[model samples]
Target: MRIATTAEDHRIAVLAALAIAIHVLETALPSPIPGIKPGLANVITVLVLLQFGWHTAAWVTALRILAGSLVIGSFLSPTFLLSAAGAGLSLAMLGLAWRLRLGLTAIGLSIVAALSHMLGQFLLAWWLFIPHPALFKLLPVLLTFAMIFGVLSGTIAAMIHRRLTIGTHQT
Candidate 1:
């Protein structure tokens, strides 16, 4: 029997594809520090969250992580684990913010996700890989990068959202 797919499914798929493309492309960019690349793909996630809802954003993000990892050849690896943990925590924070009606804009939400994502990955890496107090020193730097990238992605998302909204109203 054939399964039926709704419009929402298609929407999620398209968004996931976009996010995956961005994720894969991001891998090529050299980072000043390991694991310190700007998460431009998350711009799509923030846009999805604002335009659709947190549920759709979550679906898109999960698919992006899975497929992006597979494409990047990091599936089921330590990197993947760290990535998953970060994404899971980020999603949870977004959901909480959404449910709590915190009235956060794309920028605020992105900052929250970025900080949570960094913390989750750092904690996991410390517990699983390094297990040294010196690792804690890196937290401040990582968090600073997260905050910078978060603002950048959030600004991009907001601009895209505004253009889309204006386009919809125009036509």
Candidate 2:
């Protein structure tokens, strides 16, 4: 049976556009380190997860990563592989966090996913490209960036979620 377009489809399209835009923009910016990025696109992921569901967030992330790489010409390259792995791992952790449903809010889940994403990318990079002990040396710097950006993204996600919830209630 053919699936019909619904409000959820519209939401995914809009969210995907927002995420891909952020991803492409971020790719254009210069970073101090090779793999260190703020992952501002994560804000959309968190918003979708909290507002819609994990499946919605997954669609957004997959489309963002794939389309962002194609737009930036990183498709099927090591960069794409690393990005895909990190996103996969982060999404896994997000699903787990949501299922657990502890007191952990978006901030907590974002931090968890951010750290996992960083570690996943690092490990994949080491195995697929570096294959040297020195690869581990970058862990500290990457993790530091991850923690900082994680908090920032989470805080932004939280604020956005709050506004969305309030707006819905007021409607």
Candidate 3:
């Protein structure tokens, strides 16, 4: 039992490392819009959700958010707050998807998570930062980008999952 728990911890650490790397890399990229990010890290998050479970995914995401923010010098800043909100919303959405368990594959859950994350961040900005009705105007743009990036990230996750599963089966 101890060995199994250790293995699980190791798995979570590895997943968190991958997610943190991706998150940091994405943070370095120049966004076309203030809130528009490719969210490539979400690929790993969704993969974790599908392969392990929501708890593992949550661990990976939380680590990524914390470590990524620390590395980028945004710890405890507004940037960190937004990142936390997005990740929290993403995990919540994934949790709901897992509970529903209605034959929704990783791709579907990825889309749902992505949309929820974006909505959460946008809402946070409107409520805490801007507090203006004009902030709501960005909804369409944010949702559109979220949908596109979600599909792309989901496709990437599916491919990685396919390759990993194939390799395991072959071994």
Candidate 4:
């Protein structure tokens, strides 16, 4: 019925709004790791990808980064590069996973995404500002943390997706 469709549409919108909010809040939180974040917004994206498709998730993730940067006043700053890199890498991973039929349970996918994200940002930084190769000295450390955080975030997202599916089916 039209009513059911409308309600479902509204729920999708609400999920997207929540995704945006999570993006903003996560960005605002200070982390000891310079560019590290839980990327809580990504939870919604992964869920959306599993439920909807890669296209929808990609759009939501892109919007979150753009709007989040504007909200945090880091739109044109060096920090923005990191966020941009992460988004780009995340999107790529999502696409690959979808295409490869990689089950959401694969934590390695998240780790790869995270490593790519860190590399992207570092490459951007090196190209944009730091021309010296010596700057890469910190990469090993950052990469380690990236791997750990990526696994953590991925697990959380997967868990949330499982719960949402259960909730949807129960209702």
Cα error of candidate 4 at position 164, Å? 1.6
Q: Can you write out model 4's per-residue Cα lDDT over 93-133, one digit (the tens) per residue?
A: 76887899866553555666677778888888888889798
Question: On residues 1-171, what C-alpha lDDT tens digit does candidate 1 reach at each position?
Answer: 999999999999999999999999999999879999899998998999999999999999999999999999999999999999999999999999999999998899899989999998998999999999999998999999999999999889889888999999999
Model 3 ranges off by over 4 Å: 1-5
Of 1 and 3, the candidate ahead on lDDT is 1
What tens digits encode model 3's per-residue C-alpha lDDT throughout 38-76?
899999998898888889999999999999899999999
Q: Give the TM-score of candidate 2.
A: 0.94
Residue 82 in model 4: lDDT: 72
Task: In candidate 4, list every pair of residues with a backbone clash.
Answer: none
Please tell me which predicted candidate would have the highest TM-score against the true structure. 1
Total clashing pairs for each candidate: 0, 0, 0, 0
Candidate 1, 153: how far from true, in Å?
Answer: 0.4
The per-residue C-alpha lDDT of model 3 at residue 149 equals 92
TM-score of each: 0.97, 0.94, 0.94, 0.82
TM-score of 1: 0.97
